[model samples]
Target: MGALAQLLPLVRSARRDQDQSVLSAALQAFLDFGIKRTSMVEVARRGGLSLATLYRRFSSKSDLIQAVGLQQTREFIEGVDAAVQQQIDRDAGAEAQIVELFVAFLDGLRGNRLLDRLLDTEPEIVLPYLTTKGAPVIELGRDYLAEFVTRLQAEGKLPAYDPLPVAEMVARTALSLALTPQTVIPLDDDIAVRKYARDHVAVSFRVPVTDS
Candidate 1:
């Protein structure tokens, strides 16, 4: 099928085999020491595998990082999908649903210890993945949100629009808030963040009101 469709099975297989452990070890090392400082030896030691095995599985450090990134992105998208579906099932209003979806996403990001460590100690390693070379993950997030928005439009819960552009706006806005929140806003406050997202984002997607 598609590239992502083809990659899912490999990711799932990695989760089932020693490759998962190796990737986990690499991720842990990268989070702790930054990718540049972390070596293949350290990854092998952390994974309890021989360097040969690590090399055999992944040709280089970049390959391992790419694999880890793909897996992480997949899991992140799955979590967002679940959160959005849960809100939809609750019969929440369109705005409320979007708010809850973003809240859930932000909560996940806040809870990720690896992300916190990377942000605090090695922001450079993470910046590229979010900015310059972030096409894969960004596309994943955009496509997922676009599909969700399309569903809402089909159900008459949101206005009909080109879901891709709208989803891109939503994804980029959410990513910005998650990564570098405005200094003036109390982004650390979950309640305030939810309110801000609802006030700002909901308007864009909400069905326009007309005088009866």
Candidate 2:
């Protein structure tokens, strides 16, 4: 059998444990089956957990999904922040570093299939906190963008401008692009998505986009 087939039983056994392992299993099930197919009873059964115990841990499906979302969001923020710091420490060229960071950020976003499903199927779950709560995930992103802009501003690599508004615009723009990708009208193929991200950063810093 293939490696994945060989690992299936091991994966099941690992998930049978009653600790965070079970929760992880439940979350994975939800991601695989989606919200509509993933029910509380199914989650409990997959996790080898009792329905009562699942309820004790998570009062409802929404609560469990929220917990999973928050956990993934925190992890993503930390990973992206670390990647940014690493790129800065390497003293890579500004455009290259920005591209690397944005790609890493997009990888994180794509990995969170559950979050994507929530965005598509249940925007109500995330919209309120993303806007009104202005919680850690959003703030971390803003701070990262603001810092990148300020760095460029200090080095005179870009035009002088308030980073807050620019960061907000970039964040809002990115969010919109991610949540509602342009399907009706196709984007220009000359510039790929990664290039688009790099171009946005270059424009924000007022840097020329010519080959280095």
Candidate 3:
């Protein structure tokens, strides 16, 4: 199996998140059978949990799926945040960092067995979370990027500007591209994604924005 096919290491650096604990079993079951085929009972059994206990936590399978989407969104943010930071340390510019986040995320999603399975086998179940009803996941990424912009500002990497809108732009663009793969942009091709990010996305960070 390629590295991408491996289960994403849910624990990254020193971040201890409960989403990993709450959703690992569901992730595994979904990985094994895709969300449509995996029942709540199977999820409970895989976790050595009772159906009642599972219901107490998630209320329903749709609820569990929502939690999983939230987990995937948060993990995606933190995971690529670290990648961008690594690029910064390497003296990589904003464009390179953006490319790192963009490609890393899409590549990770491609390798994400559970999510990939959902896209392949059950689009109706998962598409809403990535699209029309995607506010929860998209908003999570936007908020994380908002806080992340502050850190970049402190490092003198970005000028003073409202972080929320900028963060939302990047978050929405990245997530949207991942969901809609059939573009002029060949997202599967890392070289193309890097070029796209450099030309279109990273330009914002290249120039300083003065407060109006």
- TM-score of each predicted structure versus truth: 0.79, 0.58, 0.79
Best by lDDT: 1
- Flag the better candidate by lDDT, 2 or 3: 3
> Model 1 off-target regions past 4 Å?
1-16, 84-90, 208-212
Assess each prediction's global lDDT (C-alpha) against the native: 0.73, 0.61, 0.68
TM-score of 1: 0.79
- Give the TM-score (vs. native) of candidate 2: 0.58
Ranking by TM-score: 3, 1, 2
Put down candidate 2 lDDT per residue, 1-212, tens digits, no spaces.
24323322333232334635556766788668766677889888887879999887666776565555445555676777787777565455567666666666665665667667767876776665455543434544666678877886676555677888777666665555556666432233423755776666556655555623
Give per-residue CA lDDT, model 3, range 2-91, as digits (tens): 221122223222223333555888888887778878899988887776888778766678778877766766677777767666655535
| Greater-TM-score candidate between 2 and 3 | 3
What lDDT would candidate 2 get against the real structure? 0.61
How many clashes show up per model? 0, 0, 0
In model 2, residue pairs whose N, Cα or C atoms come closer than 3 Å (at least 3 residues apart or on different chains), thus clashing, are: none
Off by over 4 Å in 3: 1-22, 90-95, 186-192, 206-212
